[model samples]
Target: MHPGIIFFLVILGSVLFHIFTPWYWTDIASNWGGMDDTITLTFWIGGGVFIAVCLFMIYCVLKFSYKKDRKVEYKPEDKKLEKILTWATTIGVAALLAPGLIIWNQYVSVPKNALEIDVMAWQWGWQYRLPGEDGKLGTTQVININDDNPFGINLDDPYGQDDVLIQSDLINLETNQPVKILLRSVDVLHNWYVPQFRAKMDAVPGIVTYYWFEPNKIGEYEVLCAEYCGIGHYAMRGGVEVQSSIDYKKWLSEQETFKELIAKQQKIEFGNKKIVKNNNFLLNKEIYKEE
Candidate 1:
């Protein structure tokens, strides 16, 4: 069989395999935000160029292979040809990079009115903090973990008084919910990943990191901790249920009730219960702080 034909067949098979596979990430998300579209464009263009180059090389090798006693023809390297290839490569790279940088900039620059939520990761579970009605989530630490306080918020600071805290509850917010996620790690690094949202970010210990996304679709999506942490790495998973705004509020009310039950079950003091409840609630500057 001709090498050229074999090469083409091999590439064709690989492409077909890639097409038939139902892996989640490769398939487009339910929501194609600006960043998602930019990625698609960049990948298609770059991949086309890469495959063309490979196939061209393969064809050349097969066409120009040596034969017994075959006379070899020599052609001097053309400066003009070299210059053209150099410029082509340079321009191609720039074309590929420009959109990526633009989308990245948009991702980092959070909208002025995005609702902020703080996410904390530990050995085997995930915790969340939402600004109380006041719309401010105060800074937190880990030493406060107890029956009364799961997220050690510095209550003396007054800045943390109304922040709402949650551990392992599915929050269902209304459609087009604008959420800004603040990620932190208590012990080891972890990654918060949601395939349907096309969003993922690392939860590094000792440093706070985050990402934001709007859940435009209404459905339940699986959340996975992408970073390998320990023995329970595979089991470190969660779920996000996107719902209408009204439905989300209803869910929030239920969570509040559930939290109260949890406190009673642990025989936690009312004062300490207030502290933990405030850790996940929202608080605006006017009610909590001036800044």
Candidate 2:
């Protein structure tokens, strides 16, 4: 009797705690409500199974308690009981997995008209690339990466020259615009996650993975790396700001293009060499005069 009461109390406490818990899903700002639905379905199935099992245990404790006058019956196996248990277990497992499988099927299907944005991840930072007015992104290679070309932009590629290079961690998006995010990693593996968007994908090396979502809300959201890449993994954070089309265009215009970035780097390098040559000439004239 006492054990049955404890099980009842545990079930009651669990339900109450869940109902009043402070932490729950964040407000979704994208078009992935199916993801949330799948999660809610999982919770319901799991909670139902937990309550049913506990109730059975409570019944057994109260009705089958040991007594001095009671005699035990030894029936080792019952085919009927075994079949019922097997079917119940199979149905419960299937219920938990089917919703997830359905949602995952739609998660990878990118739309035809979705805009393109490239996200590059490193140990502790994020970089982005967006297509210019040409509506196309330039190809990149790992071998082309250097101090002057951090994004590994191929200088010879005509399409890459006009690509907008965003070095900042905070990226801007247009609300109601369907955009596909292309993920890449310069170093170790990382996962880009934005809770509000309900979308994230692994940034794998030497390959690209992608997912798409249309931002329906106009606001700023926190971006987090869901994978542990290294010691600085905790600090691998970024942000996204969804705005109106006019504001997004203004922000995009303010960003530098790959062509402009290359020109600036070249000017700096040339200026440094010119300064060194002038200093050498001055030193030579001074020695010649002294002689």
Candidate 3:
């Protein structure tokens, strides 16, 4: 059999495998269905190009292979073919990129009413923080993370007093609510990713990165770290539960707050329950100096 026949068989098998493959995207539970559409568009464009190129190669192989019956014809510089190939390649690339750019614009542009939630990642686990009734999260510092103060929330900041803290692996989100997740890291690089939500972002040390998604379905989803940070990277996983507004609020009310954690920390560290220098991180501010 000619090599062209073998190549044709391989292409056919690949196409069949892709079509019958059970591995594909999980069911989307977030408002990022547009992301799925954009990805599908990419797959279509790529597949078309792959098949077209393979067919062209096969045609060339079978038609131009050295044959004693046919004299060798040396032909180069087909301007018409060159123009067609150039235009085709340009159009394919543009089609592939345009949708992603459009989707990316929407991705970074957080909705005006989207709730701001903080996600802190470490080498091995996940933590979450949400504003209390004040609707504002307190400022945080890397220097403040300790046994009792795991979130590194600035205790001096009033807004963070009511910030709800979830030091557990499971979290609950309100259905149909758009949320802008603020990603942070204290140790090394990590990522906060939930496949069903169709959004993920990196957690870089000394800085914050973010992505947003709205959970439209009331279901549980597994969250995974998409980046490798260390040996524990594979086990750095969590979960999210999308629930009704009432149920979500109930869950939120049960979580501990930063101020509460500080108070508990005070009791544990100081057996007699005492207070100490409170402005370790905030004393340098001019406003505090004047006060």
Candidate 4:
């Protein structure tokens, strides 16, 4: 019946609505990532403080509120009170931030042996490249795209010799593997989003960004584009099937041998090209303008 109670009820209802809202992207808040525990701890501490303050205000309203026929009294703000509040707030902040900072440091410093994988996003599809037998990913660009060079890897670079290019349905397997994702986009911006893993990063054109995660559980997870780029943004979805170590090994071997066959065939075809077509070079100045 009171105005204050009515106002409180309205605010409570709004908060409940937000909590129970069905709209959600990834389970980043509820699920734990590399530094998720620290985040959750900070959230709980903040929630506790909010609840304590609200309860104290409620007590003041009910206990010291206006009463009829009572003499009004007012007191000046206390310096000791302000000092106590300041120290309490400082300690609370330190308690909340210290563990979070420590965990963040660990997250940033990944193990040296952790496998690195490259993810290139384009107009509508995603391309994944692995550092084949070697532990290095070669640089790539879109200008060199062709059937022979699917991932546009720098062939002149010696480090690219053992690099693995997986552009199609090659990552499906049966085991869990730790992988670090280095993201790049050829066109507009996109997001490498995997909800179950709680991992995501922006795929910006011209610049490279990345995130790493080891899927402990095995299942088929859908990767969604968190940022809308074009009309096909809603349809920008892919599948990642995490498999066991044995199945993953088997899959990797098959991919390697298959790629080897293709590479050999391409080399042979290029070498067999005769000089018969070399004399037909036309001197068309207008048609051959440089782009």
Q: Evaluated with lDDT, which candidate comes out highest?
A: 2
- Candidate number of the best TM-score: 2
Deviation from native of the Cα of residue 178 in model 2, angstroms:
1.3
What digit string (tens of lDDT, one per residue) describes model 3 on residues 1-291?
988988899889989988999998899898898999998898888888788889989999988888879987688779999999899989989998999999898999999889999999987999899999899999999899887788888978999999999998788999999999999998898989999999988899999787788999999889899999999999999999999999999988988988888788777778643333445345557677898
In order, candidate lDDTs are 0.73, 0.93, 0.89, 0.70
Model 4 error, position 218 (Å): 1.9
Q: Name the 10 consecutive residues with the lowest summed lDDT in model 4.
A: 274-283
Segments of candidate 3 deviating more than 4 angstroms: 272-291
Error of 1 at 3 (Å): 1.2
Winner by TM-score between candidate 3 and candidate 2: 2
> How do the residues 1-291 of candidate 2 rate in per-residue lDDT, one tens digit apiece?
499999999999999888899998899999999999988888888999899999999999989999999999999999999999999999989998888888888888888888999999998999999999899999999999887887898889898999999997899999999999999999999999999999999999999999999999999999999998999999999999999999999999999999999999999999999999999999999999999
Model 3 residue 67 CA deviation in Å: 1.5
Worst 10 residues of 3 by lDDT: 272-281
Off by over 4 Å in 4: 3-36, 70-76, 141-150, 173-176, 256-291
Which tens-of-lDDT digit does each residue in 124-178 have in candidate 4? 7787777776568766767875667767777676666677667763355333445
Model 2 steric clash total: 0
Return the clash pairs for model 4, or none: 174-243, 174-244, 175-243, 175-244, 176-243
Candidate 1, 76-177: lDDT as tens digits: 788999999999999888988888788777666777788887787888778777776666766666776564556667546455666666777344545686
Q: Estimate each model's TM-score.
A: 0.80, 0.96, 0.90, 0.73
